[model samples]
Target: MQLRFLLCLCIVGALAQSDYDEDDGAEGKKDPKEIQDPRGHRPVSRGRETYSAGPAAPPPISGGSRYRGRPTAAPVGKLVLEKEEQPDSGGCNHMSEKMGVLCPTGCDLKKTVQKQERNVRPTVDQLKRSVDELTQSTNSVYGYVLDMTTEVAQRQRVSEGNGLLVGQYTDSLETQHAYIKDAVDITFPQNIKILQAVLDKIREKIQRLEKAISAQRAKCQVPCKVSCPIPVVSGKECEEIIRKGGEESQMYLIRPDPLGMPYKVFCDQTSKNGGWVLIQNRMDGSVDFGRRWDDYRRGFGNIAFDVGKGHCQTPGEYWLGNDRTSQLTKMGPSELLVEMEDWSGSKVYAQYEQFTVQGEATNYILAVGRYSGTAGNTFLNGATELFGENRTMTIHNGMMFSTYDRDNDKWIPGDPSKQCSKEDGGGWWYNRCHSCNPNGRYYWGGSYTKYMAKHGTDDGIVWMNWKGSWYSLKSISMKIRPFFKQK
Candidate 1:
């Protein structure tokens, strides 16, 4: 009943404080204790875990312990708080114990204080999420604001122009906003002290809000300085950029010298969902394996690359592999191919795609990748060359035009016997074997052949070879041979 009354008293008193503070608004709020809950029904608990005293620590080895051996003793000490009694100054801390009145900090306190802050605190995971988001937001905000400031600063400082005005009059407002943002949360306290701090900071700026706004308008009106036109990549004006020119999605442009790219990853604020990603020449962060990411491309006739610390600093050079299993189990192993998709000027395009390896015999593969980009003449930058003992046609996309295996130094001719027609039959097999085909000339991966057997080839390359080594180009000039695996 007493606890209930206390809660009522607190509520009523809080309402009273609220009544008079109407004018104060967000900033001018009264201390909580000033308010009273007439009903006295306040939220109260016996205490935290330790407070209720359910399970006590096994009695310490003290004299009180009923041990037959040596005795144990606990040192008794007293803590004294010296008080210089003074008249109560209408403060919340002021309370009369004799009058049965009580006052405690508006803390979310439980009986047992040692129950861990977690009981009344956010979990580590929650804190981490909040921190990550806040950090991202903070970085994002500063990125834009700093960019604006830098642009203005770079414009040859206008002696008697915009620079001088921006550097002076409106600086305080910006500074105040910065101060509010920089203010961090203090130790958890009953009163929302941090919130109050933010409010105070806002006030500092609100006081001069009009002056700052006017100044902002005046300075920004004439514009600051303009920088010289400079090319960012390849020393050319990037005025026109192909969406897929450099790279797209999760890329890093880290080159050598000072540094290839800026950040390790493409943290472009403009790319929220996903965007173009360019791997630069030089980078710092390394990709770890075994204990890190599991690789699904090991074995199954798939060629493996070096496993180590790697980053996509430069586009041309990249090292990606899995340390686990190294290859698949049941089905045959896959063939790994790092194909150079495009090369515009100094920039290169590369994506990880797989190819199916055929028989043990070394057979040269003549394939052309599709490039319908008619923006200009299509030129073959060449292919990623792989050399070893056995040479076989592993990568089997639907055979398109033709490919000349440089390693084999031979031009593979397509079969011209089996009634060659899109309606008749054509796929990875058709592309190379439209007519009476030779054995071992073109071998399809089990997966693709089986798929094609099921899917019809009348429309597109045999359904199985739809996504195979088949590609059409305006023209095919030179042939490049890829890495040849040992039999």
Candidate 2:
């Protein structure tokens, strides 16, 4: 109980001391804005200079003046202090007087705590801004990666479509190839059979032609190309029969070459050493001579009657075709004899030692050389003989044969153009009309002066040198024979 009374008295004394300390703190305090550091410096945040703790205080020593320990480093942030007046001495006078303890000078615990709190608020705000920047950068990277993934997927789909199209084209090509192979298999054998049948027909025709040729060869002991009027005999020409001891003036078969035709001709075996083949003969003009080019080329008249030692005995007229005549004349060195008779029964002849008629290509051009006989070279010099003109083209020699249809003559272009063949009404070698037209129209009386004068044309059998262009001939004959007899 007595100990408890003493503790109560101690509590009352401590309460009385705390009251006195509060009263003393109130008297020393100044305004918050007028606060200063222990070194009599104000805080920088309050429009005052910063308090620089220059050097650290030394440690305490025995029997020394009081010392205060302070760090040299400045505070972290803005400091706030109240203003205060400095003591005249440098000891811890204000701290000693207020706290009733020995204290270090230049130390302010209240200001240090406030500076740390100020530094912490700004550090927290900077940390928050750094976190916001990091979040924005993460969003940008995610968007780029999403765009790349979408593009790669679209390309994969396009590649699949291309692969499908390629597969379809390959299938179509294989189908076409199969169809073509099937068609070839179906038609190849049929084509071969058709070609074989055609070849068989050709072989049969060739065999039949061979048999017919063999029969023809058998009928003619010698070579014979054309059909003969009479029986086939072994004679090549009239001269050949005469050489083989044949002395007849009759229709006989003659073939010039072994491969040539066996045509019939009047063999005059009794005149001028015999063997004269008559090519043309005209007496009463029984056959028409004024025919077209084809008719003259193939010959038109028949002369199968017998001539016993005389020409035009049976009153027949004929012209051996130009092709046959050319063949016969070109067999060897042949000669031509033209016999003409007038109404007064006077006979005149023209003969050429070298005479040849060319083929149809040159319009059967005539070539005559070395004339001799009663007729005055009228065939070679027709212009001089008939019209007294020195026109060389009017001559018959070296002149192409012309017809009513084929005008190959040298006629001046004028009224009644191509008048030589048309005016003469027959085929002959005509230039400005001829001096001698042996193939002219026949007149019964042999004189047509009135008709010629009225018509202004001489279209009669006119041999101008023999009688004149005014009179037609009564009878005429043309024949050919070799210059030398064949043995």
Report how far residue 454 has shifted in candidate 2, in Å.
Answer: 9.1
Model 1 vs. true fold: TM: 0.14
Best by lDDT, which number?
Answer: 2
- TM, every model: 0.14, 0.49
Best by TM-score: 2
Model 2 residue pairs with clashes: 34-82, 34-83, 35-81, 35-82, 35-83, 36-82, 36-83, 226-261, 236-255
After best superposition, candidate 1 residue 64: deviation in angstroms?
A: 99
Q: How far off is residue 208 in model 2, in Å?
A: 43
* Tens-place lDDT digits, model 1, residues 7-42: 545654555455434424744544676544422322
What are the per-residue Cα lDDT tens digits for candidate 2 across 1-487? 3564475456545554555466458868666555433332222233333244434334323223332344234667755342344444455355443332324345433433344446544654565565566667777778878888888888888989989989999899899888878768977778888999999999999999999999998888976653323433447777888888767666777877788667767777776777888888888878888899998898768674535533322425888889888888788888888888988888899988888999999999999988989977877777455344545655788788888778888786444565687888688888776788889888887888755532568888888877777788999988888887348
> What lDDT score belongs to each candidate, Candidate 1 first?
0.30, 0.72
